[model samples]
Target: MTNDDLQFAHDRPIAMQQHDLLDRAGFAQRLALAISSWKNQESLVISLTGSWGSGKSSIKNMALEQLAAIQGSQVIEFNPWQWAGQDKLSSAFFEEISRVVQRKNPTEADKQLAKVLRRYEHRLNAGAAVLSGTAKWAPILLGSALVTTALGSVAEGTAAQVTIWTVSAVSWLGSLAPWLKQAAEWCTKRSKNLDQEAKDSELTLSQIRAELQKLLSARQKPLLIVLDDLDRLSAEQLKAMFQLVKAHMDFANVVFLLLFQRDTVEQGLQRAGFDGADYLEKIIQVPFSVPAISSGQLEAVLSGKLDAILANEQQLQQRFDKAYWDQMFQRGMRPFFGNLRHVYRYASTLAFHCRLLRGTEVAEVNAVDLFALECLRVFAPETYADMPRHKALLTNNEPFARQDEPQRARINQVINHLVFLAPSTHKPATRQLLQEMFPTLDWVFKNTEYDRQTQLRWLINSRVCCDDVFDRYFELSVPEQDVPNSLLHELARRIVDSGPFTTLLASHEEDRQAEILQRLFGLVDEFPLELSLAVVQTLLQAGDVVGRRMSFTNWSPRQQVVRLLRLFLLRHDDEAARSQLVIEAFAVGPGLVVVEQLLASEYALRRKADFGCLDDAGLEQLKSAYLCNLRELAERDPEAFLANPDFESYLYDLNRYGEGGDEGRRWSERHITSTTRFLQFAQTLVNTRSRYSGDGVTHIDEISLHSLDELLGKECCADWVARLDTGELSADASQILGLVKEALAHPARSETAEWND
Candidate 1:
């Protein structure tokens, strides 16, 4: 089959008998039998009544097919909706009948009947003209309304107000214009001065009716006229149609199978001061309400069609399961439809949108979620429109500040109203469906509550409920700057060195880069069970650049990468594999910072053994490797090594591990020859306190003598301070010297002050 054929359904009616899915052909069989009987001499008007979209057109077509079996039978169809405006509905009706008669093997009696049908229409118009003059006051009344509006506006209004008032008056007068028009159309059915021709118009209509009945009686078979979509016409059009059947066409061997909603037709009739039910009773000889479809049939047909729309695509099938289908479709989507048209309409929409998302990158929107949202879109359309506008409140899971709690609660109330505000019949079921979509609202509805961990799983599953991807379902495609799941999968598969990874992230705007990194956080959990060193190194390299840009509530992208590494390590089934991956990455990896922080966090978690992975021995191996990598980096490029953002933090961690006291002193003296380099390394070690006094905030740079003595040795610092070129020193350099001189002159304290970073 061609791709276009498979892409979407046209929602056309079931025209042929074989296409009847609801067994509605049984009603068609009964209708055909009535038309064939020809039991009455006077014309028969049978109504095939049902609500709109109840498959009336489809059923009517099936009946017409059944009628085709009868030999010598004639059929004519009138579509009043085509000529809805103007006074041509009645004229068009006769023209259609005459056209059908002349085209359909016209016999002598049929030719006379066709000519008389035209003459009778002219007679009816002539008689209708006599009553038109009685309603001429309607125009005078409308003219008075316009004149009053103009005068009132001129007396108390500006130019804009006068224009608006005139427009309102014209609009109000237009509604009565049709009614007033009937009054101005006058012809004398019983005139004095206009001569016998005016009064003869009424007499001529009677003679034409007599001739029409005589011509129609000679027909061998009934001319069955089917009028579908009668409810689609305006009240005036409806009135004209009823008058044509009741007064003009009560002849022998003619049948009308009128398809309309009973209530709507009655409403149209009521607008013309006729009791609609009573008028229909007078015209229709036999009434057949279209058969009600069983709910089982609707579900079965929709399920079969949904299968066709979804097709056999494996990617879409993976997102759906029997349990989800039961909750979302069988229970959630099923309740909204009341008839066959609703079912077909939903199937058509599903087909079009499902095709749009067919080859999307890495299965962007969940197919089942699309079905759920489509249900809302088709049935509760107002709420569906609100989905994109209220995306934040609907998908929110993060806790808000205490001060903002009331505002959030108010927003939650609005979200809650969506469940309650549905059409009364669907309200309870809508809540059931919405709970499946946004489980975070369970607390408000007294359902089982979901935690952040559940929300995390929703993200990994790429559900419509996930805030990261909620807009995709509405937009029907991945947006610009969006981290499509396909792209992430490709990135993970083709991962290379840190430079490429860093460049890929840096290519986006800063916030978009943060989104890419955050999505990577979940991608870590989704990584294949086999943890590769290339993956680890790429993240380590990429993370080196994921610095400070972030939401305050979220960890910086750099730190997020640290969490990603920890999750990456935890993926291994073997404990030794996890510890070895860290050690291996550090050995070949550029920086020791990621390894130090990861192992340190694991070490902390080990005390509780809740999230910890390594034993004390494996932990010590990672720490030692961190120190080794740090010094190796310094040895290779001291300038770049000293500039590392994590250098001070890693050094403190190294000292805490009980392996950095002497090594830190020797490395600093060798690499830190200049006074500038000395202050850079020493800043973290000194305690800088701020005190507010008469003198604006002064920095008390407390240089502990014992801290220097324990780590770098007091004598070593004093010697470095004494050798400073005092004359060429910068402001910061002079301040560093002053602090060290004062500390070395005093008696050193016993307890050393620690590095505070």
Candidate 2:
């Protein structure tokens, strides 16, 4: 996705010091040292507890690594979560420990003790299996009565199934007296033998217990059984596990190290019908709370991961300042990370997003802004979710649009409610993070707001606070037709080369072409003078292409360029410098469309006095230049000049600037000799409007004779009309002439109809 190959950070625990970015080894070393020195001959259950993702498992691993260096200690990991929903976890756990002790270089004596322990567990297991066993449907004949009943009660006691079956079969043969006598004697003899064996085997459980105690005491090394992820178990599983540990408290030289979140385990214990506090208190011989990871350590972990990822991405690194990142982390981002897990989670998420955005798009966005916003997204999703909906209020600097009090209040209410999702300790920092992104949002709490430059810089730098670039961040791709500021800046820089820029602009669809001009106009209004001058110059040349597609109405890209010119001119207080800049611009011959636009604006200013930017002498200079440029164009290409869409406007400006009296008509006569040229001239004088009837009929209004006489001399048009041969004229030319002369007598009043665009 990017040239810089960003890597994801895994969420697993750090098993070695090289991966320990949080500096947790010191604490783990102390724990291992304390346990190794303590000579507890009997069984001990030590709990190393912390909250979820607080590195409880990591610290346990570190401590065990240190303990492995000691002369006489062995570690065994027992995972009770995997054995959940089983019928005999207790027996399974005993069998596991006994197998471990026996398999690890055991002596003859150890072998005998392990064997006895295994046998005892098997016996208990067999007893439990018999109590739970299912029996098929069967009937028993008891003293001439047939009974169908469950044998569960008898299964639980000493009454055996084999003995009952023998009695039942012998009763069926009661007619054979000798066989009945033999069956009765055999049952009595079997019962006496079972009684003798039961008396002899009464000490089996105690004997196995004594044997394990003796064997563990004689061991050269202490057996350290480590159990992790205990908090992940269900209520019933937690109860079973704690009961197993409680049952084995009498074993000498055996130590069990338990790792879990204390609260979760307690909650599960309470759900399983035990006083969680008391139950844990009885079983836990040594308890140690995993040290609270400091905020600095958490920040270090996050920074390390981010730095590693950023090191791979050079574009981000070029813009990254350690001082700024540290400051932002301290003020807002630091509070979002509460543990090592949070750091890894955020790093992995950031890496994935950075990789998803292609290089150009990544370069278009500011790195710090991306980091802060991504921090919001990962740690506080609900707060981030509300951001894009209020893009206008957050980014728009227009004075009128920003005065929506109700909308601002709703945003304020939403921001204030963000505290509910965040922890109490980090709520203020969370608000600060938002305020930093949207300075206008500060008005809610700080009674102040940022000025336009702050917002402008955000737009120019492609920060999420800028409205145009904001959605690109959330959507993770640039819109197809939209122009990103990166490419726009490049275009502005290369505007001096009008060849490529004009060609590229023309290649787009008409709407997108207008959109490019719109963006350029904004740049002309706000960019530095050096670049703005080049951009306005380029727009003037490009406007001819865009203006051809436009209806010369409100959405005219040509009109937007004029407005930008006004904005630019008004920015300079000196009339001379501004007028000189515009004249020089016109001197370069930026086409007829833009020249007429400026001159027309000056005429409007003279009538309404609603604008500024040029003086009378400057206007005369511009008029002289336009006249010279206009004459040269007519002399250079007469047919092309006459066929131009705005032929009427160009001729009017020429006559207005000309020494007067039929100069434009005489010039038009050079090219308007044929019906084709006359038809093109008539095309410029018509207006179309929707009729007032409900049937949606449109009426084409034409200029009256008097108006035509004022523009073109009456004698000039009368002579031309007399000279035209009706037979030689094409059908289209003849129709246009009829329409032109049809309204000459009545003189229809032409309204300034709005363009459909």
Candidate 3:
């Protein structure tokens, strides 16, 4: 079979037949020697104690295998937990011993041994029968005696009472005589049987021991009985098994190997009301606690499992070098290796994800980072949850000012909790390790300066562990039939080839098309300049299929295109390049959406305390470009521009006066220069209104008056005044002129006079 066909065997605890992880400590050989040296002696109980998954069972199996190779040794395997609810633990154990002994030596002496074992069984059964009889009759007999005594106490001084009592006593005696006689006969028979049984049991014990001694002497090998999974038994059953082995089952030439996790078994014993340590000490002659696996051994086993799972995947090997693996193992996975099952769990998780993402053309994902993440996912799930939630911070992409203090503190709490939950020796190292893997965490939690170089190196080497890659991983991890990776790959290829994105969208269902578009949207952020341009162009071209008005999250396809193009353009410092991209986007459709997006970015920059990384000149250039694009859209399609919902909002922004400074003066000057178009648009509104008669108001009158008021102090106000004086203005404009004159005549009082009123 191929190596790939070979299942990841270490996914579970290594079984006894599999000695791969067992031989590392040479436990089998050492234990075998210990057992071999105890030749035909009195019963020896050897307890292998370790934490769960610490290779106790594996060691026991190895030792048993070693014993199997020895001459004249007989091994009996018993699982007390399996027989737990089926029978009494002691009976099941003794029955197993008797069966094993019979199977080992089926001769005339063996028949005698069997007879002795039967006598022992009978002795236990007879005692149990006596106890059962007493439990059954004791309550009934006591109740009857209490009733008779109460009657005797109450029976007072009258002849009728005496006669009644006498009759009742007679009747009771007549009824009780038969039962008493039966009880007497039963006790007599039972007493006789007990005496005979005692004599037989004593003789049987002698013969059984003698026969065992002879059989063992002739064979020259000790009997090895391996009892495993005692921890799985209930508390009562575990205690009974221990008592049975310690009290009745101890025989010469016999060795009992009890495999258990010390703490779990001890807790069970304590809960069962026994002094666990003292009780175990009395029963276990030789206690061998399996030493922890060394770091070197753990590393070897983990690396071997990784190699097996990653075989034939050369790209992963190239990306995940020895140094990378070492860093992840030492930092993230090392602490988990106290138990070998942890190694299997993490490796299996990694292998599963690797196989999932194997041939897909995903973003560059470092194998070590994936493995480290899987370690967190498996061992520290709360911490793993924070990885995705605070991904931008962890990857050093989030701005310092934007970092959530509570979220940062929460992440620290999770890390500290994990460290505190770890072994004491490992706490410091674990904290350091997590800090190294996520350096931004050091900055957030420890207030240490972020190591940009180190973080950048990790980003370059292991992008998959970060936020963007994680998003993509989850996107691709879904079934191909559901998400269709091949279709996404095809879309990417077509985008590079400048193929029609609309054609691609037309082929899929609406929801599937949306999924493809969203995937492409994320890809735009990851792709390079050329590929990003191709993606934006595809989205623009797909307007036909997605429809010009098709909106998601309240954004049209054109708006989304504008959003992506703006992000792509900002990456380039070359103004000419950005302008060219803007022009190309504007050349398609009316490009009003692009203008809106640019204005939004400007407002965002204006709100930043330090303008982020952009200087005053860069900010000016962006704002200028925004206005220039808006002017182009207005000049190209004035009606369409006026009809836009943001048209009034844009005018308001242009007329806005900034707070004091050189910047404020510059903004005022720019607003004055930009009002020429505003005056012309105001004139259109004035002309649209008919001559007003009486004092009736109209929509055009309100529009004209509001526009004229907005231009009151600007350079465009004079042009409107000249129009009113020359009679070129309509009656509505003339009315606004009268209001302006009134305002000028009485500055404060005229302002209070409502023209519409």
Candidate 4:
């Protein structure tokens, strides 16, 4: 589309070709006729007041357009902000007025009026300059005046007073003469001929008024000078501009329409220590505020923009059906639509991103989600920043930590701030919009719960919100190339179809394969349960494909597969399925690393109260599978198994299970194999005392004693206990053996004793 096609109604005031959407109150028509039908009233100042971006400019433009059709009316548009920092506002105002007045067919009377206005302007400048100079030396001038007055008064007093005052005057004048002469010369150089200057200044306000009337008497139309964007001026400039219109711009047959955001200009005046309300009341003879835009009108305008952008894309357009569009408009876009400018800004951002991202083959993005994200990005940037950084919280998959409470509170505060800051009528809907955008916030706001599937669907559709779908949207550098969406879709289809894993692997480079697999794994969480199960099953059966690509990096194919399994087990609430999956993974020989991953996955689920995935039977089965794998590894290559980095965690898991439940006893018995191996394990624990010095000692001590007691009768281990009493063993070893001896001596009392002791 061309730039003109892309422009929204509010991008510029309703052009000649553009229809008026904001003249709902007929304020523009009334305003135009008001200016056109002006009688011989003194120069009138009419103010069009509204908040910034509240369609004031558009309304003014519409009124001016209407005025164009009125017979004999001449309109001049002047923007004070345009001349900002250039010259005094008063001087610029008169210059513009003169320029406009002089352009009335160049009649002799118009020429005289322009010439007289310029002369008034020059005289005003000269007077200001003279006053500025004189004010600078007022102290010296005052001192001389006081001295001369005292000398004159002394002559009427006693002889002694007269003599004293004469002496004082002489001393003061002797010190002040050089400064006085310099001040006089400064004034003389700046001053014009006194008599002629007075003659030029003879143009009084009344005479200027009469001359303006006489000049406009022959004209067929009234004069309308529209001054807009006054709020854009600096505080000093704003105050000066209004003051100039009040003092000098008042004339018969001329109408001045001043447009600005009321609060902005009033605040500017207040900042400059003026009674802003009173000042405005005096300057503006007729004040009219742009009425609020109706929802029907706003929706019409927004729909127009949306239709223009979506005109060519039937598929994208279908996504925004009537009900969906209405909901989104009322819930998302409508509340934030403060004015035409707001609509333009939001629509522009939506159009820009949609144009850039539409029809991309690599990412399966939803158009509505993209629009919602852009809305947040533009109107509520802080909320947007928080959303992506805390996605887990938004999705309710994770809770905010104690340390994050402050930030959570801040995010809530910002949301609340935006809610209150929104228009009062829209506050309720705006709050709902925020909750819809970030559902995790509902815990605090107590809003309705959004459908998780729908939320995830929307999230995955936008590149900004879904990191797995595409490269970071806000990153500074651009990617060299993006993976095609068609390729990703095909890869997913193949995996779902139970196609050969190596076929997929052989088709792409290792890195690309890893990214493809990662993206596939991302779908397990975003899609439904059946689809997720299919993805998990595909990964499970592709062990050889994954193993070949395993590397030290965390994102290797094996790790990706392992993570997908963990996510599946954690995310699905079926305990039997999770148990079966764990059993199958171990049965397939998923190495010691995958075993540890399974253990961690279960532990996290239990910790987060998300353990619906593994029931009692499933738990027993998972624990059994875990112990049996470790037992075989220990028997096959004990040293390598013990030397594995995950060994301690495995041991900890064993201790955790053996301390409670029937499966604990069976797990310990099945794993402890022989007395010699039990003793060897006990010895290993002692040798690694420093490693288990802190909280580790508790689990190690308990497990060591329990294993020794179970493998050998409690009484038969007396010799082992004696080795500890003889102090031949280290403190940690002795500690465990001593606990065994105590247990044999008094089982009940020892059971009650703290493990640390």
Per-residue lDDT value at 79 in model 3: 91
Better of 2 and 3 by TM-score: 2
lDDT of 1 by residue, 121-182 (tens): 66655434333432444446445556455434443324455455545555667866554333
Against the hidden true structure, what lDDT does model 4 obtain?
Answer: 0.60
The lDDT of each candidate is: 0.70, 0.68, 0.58, 0.60
Least well predicted 10-residue stretch by lDDT in candidate 1 = 184-193
Model 3 score (lDDT): 0.58
The stretch of ten residues in a row with the least summed lDDT in candidate 3 is: 657-666
> Clash number for model 1?
3
Model 3, 1-757: lDDT tens per residue?
A: 3624534445454445565554533776678778777775678899888777788777766666666666435677889987744235556665776687678546765555556565666655555665655455454345466324423432222334434443454456566655544543444445555556656566554565565556554445676788998888888888878877876444666788899988888889999999988889989988988876777788788778888766745446655667766766666567766667877777766766776655445324566666666765676565555545556655556554445677677667766765665456555655665665665565576677645344434444444534435454444354433444345555656764434555776676654565455545444434566655555455445543453334323455445455545555567777566555554544553444445455565567678743322345544565565566555654577556555555554554455522231332232234433333434444333322333568873533333334344533433455545555754655655665655554444555433323321
**Higher-lDDT candidate of 1 and 3:** 1
Instruction: Please give the clash total of every predicted structure, in order.
Output: 3, 0, 0, 5
> What's model 2's TM-score?
0.80
Q: Return the lDDT, model 1, position 264.
A: 94
| Pairs that collide, model 2 | none
TM-scores of the candidates in the order shown: 0.77, 0.80, 0.58, 0.57
- Candidate 2: lDDT over CA atoms? 0.68
